[model samples]
Target chain A: MLIDIQNLVKDYQMDSVDVAALRGINLQVQKNEFVAIMGPSGSGKSTLMNILGCLDNPTSGVYRFNNTDVTGLNDDELSDIRNKHIGFIFQSFNLLKRMSALENVELPLMYAGIDKAKRMAMSKQALEKVGLADRMKHRPSELSGGQRQRVAIARALVNNPGMILADEPTGALDTTSSMEIMDVFKQLHTEGNTIIVITHEREIAACCKRIILIRDGLITSDTPNLN
Target chain B: MQQIRDNITKAILSLIDHKFRSFLTILGIIFGTASVIAMISIGEGTKKQAIAKYQDLGVSNIIIRDKDMTDAELQTVRMKFSKGLSVEDAKVISDVVPGVVSVSPQSEMKMEAKVGDRSAKASVIGVTPNIVSILNYRTAKGDFLTTDQYDRQLKVCVLGASIARELFSYDEPVGKSVKVEDQWFEVIGVMQPKALFTETVGELASRDLNNDIYIPLSTFNKRIPKVNPFTSDVKQLTVKLGNSEQLLPAAVVVRSLLNRRHFNNDDFSIIVPYELMKQEEKETRIYNLLLLSIAAISLVVGGIGIMNIMLASVLERTQEIGIRRAVGGKKKHIMSQFVTEAVVLSVAGGIIGVILGVTLSLVISWTTAVQTTITLYSILMAFSFSVIVGITFGYLPAKQAANLRPIESIRHE
Candidate 1:
């Protein structure tokens, strides 16, 4: 299993009152599985994504990633796991505006302490994989919405992380651009990379190999996509 | 090493993004460092000038000058058998004081030096020929007075550089005769110009040595008539000591010996150039400390300015911090990045400040009479001080930037 989460509980302090963002959740994801986590607004889907991405801690649970217990890891160790094992893609295509596409793609590798020359080559290869070979030097503002998202994906892939966790990665794009992003995801899945995309859109979820629906801080459904 | 380089490049690029803000931020540092270097230069220059002035006075020498007093005071001293400062005092001090090298007695009388129709008021000083060695003076054009001249009481004198130029504006003074008051004296030599006297030393009045005339003391006593009946035998004694370590003790010995010989009349004062130089150095050190402290305060203020700007920058770049954290950057990495930016800012400021300070020192020395010396240690000191300020002030904001929660910041608009 790439991720084995058991009875995860997450709580929040909203105006001095205990509010549970994710409650009593048990989920497991295997290697090379393309999964989509879907939920409406305030259904705790984003909270789940935060925990899965190692950006936050579950109030209580066992989160074993790559067969290592990830719970109770210090901030630096969590950062290490995030750097070497998990890659994050954001809805707004969070590419650093000041950096060129290639430079943006090199961020994770830099955090991994990769050598500069090898980092450059690896970033270039990642960008080329995302079909942005000609746009390596272009900044995020200079690229179209789809191209910027592709750059974000290239960044996610550069460090060769075990799983790609994208939270509504195509939410800011037009329909055609969203379709192009889904196609990139499909190609990566076919290449045996485990991908987890968090989105509420039905069509985006339909393209995944398996889908899980979350509601009211609990998993409502989990099933393989038949089409 | 690569991580640090990456942080530095990132910092540079980001600072370049807001060039105007960066410039404004480092302005305080520039002025602070510049003032540090410039003030130190001025202080060092002033010290060097003082040292040169003392060197001209002879650092290993002590001087005793007769106090100028009213006739009543002079009569009171004479009645008490105190004939003021005399040649006997020089002779006794050289013989009695331990570590004494030699002594030369000198007398002065203001007289008009006339060469042809050109006339100038000059102080005519009379001294033994041995004064040339005791006071370390040299003749520029011709030889100084010989012992034969002093033994024969010859009416021959050496004109001071300024007096020579005044009496012989178009002719050579060494081979000519000049009229002093009513007596005519042949000019044997011209003395080299000495440093200008701007302050009174002990009881020695502030007068230009270059405007004086040098003659044999026997000639002065025989040829020149005293206007006042209570006039002392000689005006001053320049006592040379063997070494500076013996200056104070030798001065004390000479002072008490003179006190007994003159009946404790308090008619003379002793001045040690080495002691005066030490006092001046102490005063300059205090003054330099004041200047340095003021400069240091400005550098601290500059650091505060950097801190303020960095705090605002950290706030503005919240999203960037979030992105980097999400991409696996540790808190230490974020801290290093911001601190690197601050260091780069201050180092840039330091370079500009050093250049400005050196130029300002040069300009000051160029345009004014004040001297300025730019030392390498001052440059290094100012530069390192700025770098330290950058690090000290940069840390807080970097910590703030590092501690920012990534999830909330990323979700922030």
Candidate 2:
């Protein structure tokens, strides 16, 4: 198993009151599974995604990644795991505006302490993989919305991590741009990359191989999306 | 290494992006560093000038001068059996005082020196042949007086630098004839240019050493007549010591001896150049301290300015920090990046400040009477101080940037 979680609970302080964002959830996923976590707003899907992405600590849980318990990992260790194991993409395309598309794609490897020549070659290859090879010198502001999102995806794929965690990746796109993004995801899935996307859009969720529904901090349905 | 390079690149780009803000941010550092170098240069220059002035007077020497007085006052001292500072006093001091090297007596009479119808006012000084070695006086042309010529009472003289230039504008001064107050004298030598005292030193009257003529004491005594009948045989006694450490005790001994010899008339005064130099050094040291404290105050204010801008920068770049953190940048990475940015700002400011300070020093030396000296150490000290200020003040904002939560900041607008 690539990821395992049991009895996960998350509580946050809101105005001096303890609000439960996640209440006793259990889930497991094997490697190379394209999964969609579907939920409405305030349904705690983000809280679960944050925990799984190693961005936050669960209040209590057993979270094992690749058979190693990650629940008790310190901040630096979690950052290392995020650097080497998980790639994240966001809906609004959180690309640094000051950098060109190539530099944005090179950010993760720069943090990994890779040298210049090698990092450049790897970033170029990643951008080429995302079909953004010609737009490498363009900044995010100079690119259209779809091209900017593609640059963000190139950044996410640069590290070649074990899985990609995307939070509402298509929520900001129009229908045509969203369809084009799904086509890219289908190709990535065919190439056997494990992907987990969190979104409330029905069409985006249906494109994944597995679907998990969450409501009020609880998992309501788990099924293979054969559509 | 690559990480650090990237961080520095990002810092330079960011600074270039906001040119006006960066300039405003480092204004305090620029002024502080400039003040540090400029103030120290001015202080050092003043100190060096004072030292050179004292050194020209001879640090290990004590002077006994005849008090300026009216003829009535001179006659009163003369009747009281006090002949003022004289050749006899010089002889007694050299003979009786411990650590005494030699005593050279001198007499001065201001008169017009004429050469080929060209004339200039000059103070004609008379001295023994030994005065050259005792006072370290050097000649630029020919030689000083010899004992043979002095004992024979020859009417030969040496011209001071300005007097030579005045009496013979193009002709060679040595072996030429110069008339002084109706007496004709052959010039045997010309003295080198000496430093001019711009201000009065202690009780010593300010006068140009370059505008004097030197002649043998025997020739002066036989040919020159005293304006006042009650005037002493000599005008001043210059006493040299073996070392500077013996100056005060030697002065005390000379004073007591002179007091008894002159019957306690107070007709003469003793001036120690070494003692006066020490007092001036102390005064300048205090003045330098005051200037340094004011510069330090500006440096502190500059550090605060850096802190203020860095804090604002952290707030503005929250989303950027979040993006980096999500891409696996550790807290230390973020911390180093921001600190590097601050250091870049200060170092740029420091470089400009050093240039300005050097220019200010040159301007001060040129436009005003104040002298300025620029040393390498002052530049190093000011530059290092700015770098330290960058690191010290940049820490708080860097910590704030590092400690920001990636989850919340990524979502922040």
Best by TM-score: 2
Candidates, DockQ:
0.82, 0.77
Model 2, B293-348: lDDT tens per residue?
A: 89878977998999999999999999999988888889999999999999999998
Pairs in steric clash, model 1:
none
Residue-level lDDT tens digits of model 2 in A37-151: 9988999999999999999999998999888899999878888888888889898999999899999999999888889899899999988988889999999999987888888
Weakest 10 consecutive residues of candidate 1 chain B by summed lDDT: B197-206
The predictions' CA RMSDs to the true structure, in order, are 2.1, 1.9
Q: What is the lDDT of residue B401 in candidate 1?
A: 96
Give the top-scoring candidate (DockQ). Answer: 1
Candidate 1 C-alpha lDDT tens digits along A1-227:
89999999999999999999999899999999999999999999999999998999999989889888888899999899889888899998888889999999999999999999999999999999999999999999999999999999999988888699999999999999999999999998888889999999999999998999999999999999999
Error of 2 at B228 (Å): 1.3
For candidate 1, what is the DockQ-based docking class? high
Clashes by residue pair, model 2: none
TM-score of each: 0.95, 0.96
Output the worst ten-in-a-row residue range by lDDT, candidate 2 chain B.
B128-137
